[model samples]
Target: MAKALHPTQVIVRPLITEKAARLAEENKYAFQVHPDADKTQIKDAVEKVFGVKVVKVNVINLQRKARRTRTGHILHGQRWKKAIVTLAEGHKIELFEGV
Candidate 1:
């Protein structure tokens, strides 16, 4: 069986961006989560850490992109996972409130 991760380990950080802000208005929030974590783990982590009811969870795998340096070499960016969590209608996470 796979080892379970703690809530803190599952959630890397809150994604604070223009798009995230707009989603928050509709009771949805975005978080940068552990790439290995699944949708159910993300849902449980969000609920446990934020103390909110999770209505739905959506995940997106952001692939690495290749970029060239000024000198000459090409490098690839790191791959990460993003989770868009929709909370229950009356619930809200305070962290996104002021942003």
Candidate 2:
């Protein structure tokens, strides 16, 4: 059987919470990405979109947790991956500027 080679898509949004924003300014940018996305794809996407040299890419896979609704219905959260990309020192991406 032959498998398809669909390229992983990169979502162009950063986690801009207080902590994430601080980290981004400190050379660590956090992004919510696809679970199937690998380190190389992440690093390349970040560099290409942000125009910064990615030093390293750290991926974290998060498990979906079950949540109960007010109507007593239970549902599972979405499973996804997060990437913490470290950029070269002195190089910064201004996506969070004035935010």
Top TM-score model: 1
Write model 2 residue lDDT over 5-83, tens digit each, in one string: 2333674357888888778667787898766677888887777777889999998988999999999999999888889
Candidate 2: worst-modelled 10 consecutive residues by lDDT: 1-10
Instruction: Mark the regions of model 2 whose C-alpha exceeds 4 Å error after superposition.
Output: 1-8
- lDDT at 30 for candidate 1? 99
- For residues 1-99, could you state the per-residue lDDT of candidate 1 as single tens digits? 335888899999999999999999999999999998999999999999999999999999999999999999999999999999999989999999988
Which pairs in model 1 have colliding backbones?
Answer: none
Report the backbone clash tally of model 2.
Answer: 0
> What is the C-alpha local distance difference test score of candidate 1?
0.95
Instruction: List the candidates' TM-scores in order.
Output: 0.94, 0.83
